[model samples]
Target: MNEDPGRDVEQEEEELFEHYRFKVDPGQELVRIDKYLIDRLPNTSRNKIQSAARNGSVVVNGKSVKSNYKVKPKDEVAIVLPYPVREIELIPQNIPLDIIYEDDQLIVINKPADMVVHPGYGNYTGTLVNALVYHFDNLPERKSDYYGRPGLVHRLDKHTTGIMVVAKTEDALTNLAKQFYDRTTERRYHALVWGDVEEDMRIEGNLGRSFQNRKVMTVFPEGDHGKHAVTHVKVLKRFGLVTLVECKLETGRTHQIRTHLKWKGHPLFHDLEYGGDRIVRGTTHDKYKQFIHNCFELIPGQALHAKSLGFQHPKTHEWMQFDSELPQGFQELLNKWERYVTE
Candidate 1:
């Protein structure tokens, strides 16, 4: 039950590194380290492996090595590099963006649901990055020349709506990144959960990729696995069957709010990944079931929104805050619930 002081939260704006390890066979012949990795790491090229070496990411037998260094028998090779398995070309597409604020150093956006933040795996296009590429003419070019991502200081889930910031300059990027890393930024989410929440509460746990489902996160109550996460919640309104709540994140782990709320026994309404799509509470009458089903249909996914954000201006060092209204569907769903409870 002990908690580590260090928390693990994945900000979408931050670059994620993929970790790799390889142990050379005892009888393996010496060969160029770069060539050795090219055969082992799928889709990676010689140039990319060499670049990783130059960045001190590639190690052999516990020491960083040059790409041309010989791989000896029993050598243990490891690397940590930005993910995507391979480079991808970023194409600027003329997608619409709901821009909230913009300056020479950064841009703020009120993102909509159903838009992936950046491209990866099956989602290589139609993301916020593609739209950003088309929208902004002067994005800061990364020093590492990493492909396909830009300007992002943090990200929202594809199905989650809310405010986000993007950096426009290298200095802005660095300083903004530091702010997020130091946990100085403020983020608030509005979530409609399946059951009435009577009291305000704080939830804490270690969050990690679910061992049973790699696609989603799970809570490790013992704090022995995953990264530490904390969320504070206040009930905003109460329907006998459901509750509207505001969640403030202390750590932004991937799916932190969703998973922690699930562990707290109040998974968000219509949260398909965490089994909130079903009638977790309320009357078992067919009418009630049908009404719940209809509510689920109104919102495309989980009824959660990143309603507000606060952070220091990366350049001016001024305190900046922004808020967004709930999306149309979320408002409509809540209205329906209010009517249901009153009637």
Candidate 2:
């Protein structure tokens, strides 16, 4: 499995409701499943395991089991549970949000680039969550089993600009979270990548953090490691050496699009982590190199935008879709590319 840099297994698992599997040792003695799990799973409490078992979330040998069930030798055990919560003081900051739509149930915002979605280790202030708590009251905070991100059902990377939907009430939070987890929500991203992608294609692979570089994700084509992820790419426009494509996610793993596209021989322009910051498909001329450098300077990070989002409204059950214009920097970069191609 891929590991997020600077985060432990528990933290990573808790970021989303995750499925965990364990194999009882052949030489192991009989023990209550909940107690056994409490020992094996770090930071997870006995009450949480028991609750999951009572809810039929714990399974052994293909059948659901109660917390009192004794785990047998060579038993295949699996459980579904949300990540444990970390106690951190959430300080609300008076940061302005670009609200796209808001109602009693939810709020949608056009997130700007370079803004971290939530506060974490090195990012303790100026986060979208900080802004959220300041601007909105009674926002549903994720349960202890889920990540501690208030009102957030999903997230975007710090440098990735896009649209995000925030839940205002618990019902809305649960419903929206379920939609995202079930892959029922629609999310489309526009990305500028190095290389001229010849045709539309689907990229399927297992994504995991690289052992060599803990901060960057890598594709495991053999499926031997990591979580399964899929991204569909459709060419929108081409700029000789680089291409703009629409990426539709079939599964939303961490850094899924960036990792998948990199594995497919196309990295987003100026994506420093994925090697797109350097010239990968361009000429050796000094003038071309300088032009590429100038282009990179226009964006804070990778040339990717979360342009559209669609989901069912929890309160009304109505299908809702929202589209966002590209950020000014991204638009200007595209304009520069167009001008270069035309000239």
Candidate 3:
């Protein structure tokens, strides 16, 4: 139940060499490592979970096991958690980042749908952190110790592409984070959801972790530990049961728009971890390796885009705004399948 503690709890950020230990609850038995840890490890993608499990970083019942290993109740789970780190030498390889705007205070990048912004349970490499590591000489390897995250002011869902601001400096990071935390940040997204939904509507609810699954969030009538989130939606396209909607946020919370839409009975397509798993089972051209492209046009991931971001420049002390168009794939899919709504 223990490993190296010298650097595990140290002030180091990018300790790609340090490992961690995870214990499994024997009460929750008979589940695959990747499947089980994917839910248990919040902020980590399933693909990375599989990779970690395969690499022997994940243990089951105190024994190294494959990602597909099944756990029995009372099995002590252990994980040699990888430290969040960039390769320490990777140059920012000109990966075609869509920069909307940049200033002394902060920078905005149009994050792709599949882009992971920071370090998490299974994601140890190839992320915005890696990119920033190469782009900026000193972007702060780890913003916090316990989480081992970056200075990302906010995050878009890995599958939900769009605009997000990155703070290159500590003061800017704190200011931007406070704006979001104080509910003063203005953000919006283009979301193509299943089912025709109302236009220009406000959704208010107390969001909390789902009792059914810790991996998902839900809207509840009664108060929970979750924060209050407010979202406004306006319809852009309609296809009988599904519709393209634009959402603006008054309060930024984890998966606020996505979780809220799903709670309202209109989950985004391709959101496997959420209620969107049903889309993969669709009849036509459905089913792909762990995903489905079901956008009225075309999307390899969910049809949510972080289109616009508005916030006061932390350093400049002036209001700044940025916007990003949909990625080519999302736009192309929208053009092609815009009418395929035979439903």
Task: Provide TM-scores for the models.
Answer: 0.74, 0.78, 0.64
What is the per-residue lDDT of model 1 for residues 246-342, given as tens digits with 9 covering 90 to 100?
9998877888888988888898999989988898998799998899889988888899999999999965789999999999999999999989988
lDDT of candidate 3? 0.62
Query: Which lDDT tens digits does candidate 2 get at residues 139-183?
Result: 454333332346566778888999999876545655665567668
The residue ranges of model 1 lying beyond 4 angstroms of the native Cα positions read 1-86, 138-149
**What lDDT score belongs to each candidate, Candidate 1 first?**
0.78, 0.81, 0.62
TM-score result, candidate 3: 0.64
Note the residue pairs that clash in candidate 1. 9-253, 13-154
Candidate 3 lDDT, 66-146, residue by residue in tens: 778886766666554333333234334334567777655566888876767764446545667667656554444433311
| lDDT over C-alpha atoms for residue 329 of model 3 | 77
Worst 10 residues of 1 by lDDT: 1-10
Candidate closer to the true structure by lDDT (higher is better), 1 or 3: 1
Error (Å) of candidate 2 at residue 233 is 0.2
Ranking by TM-score, best first?
Answer: 2, 1, 3
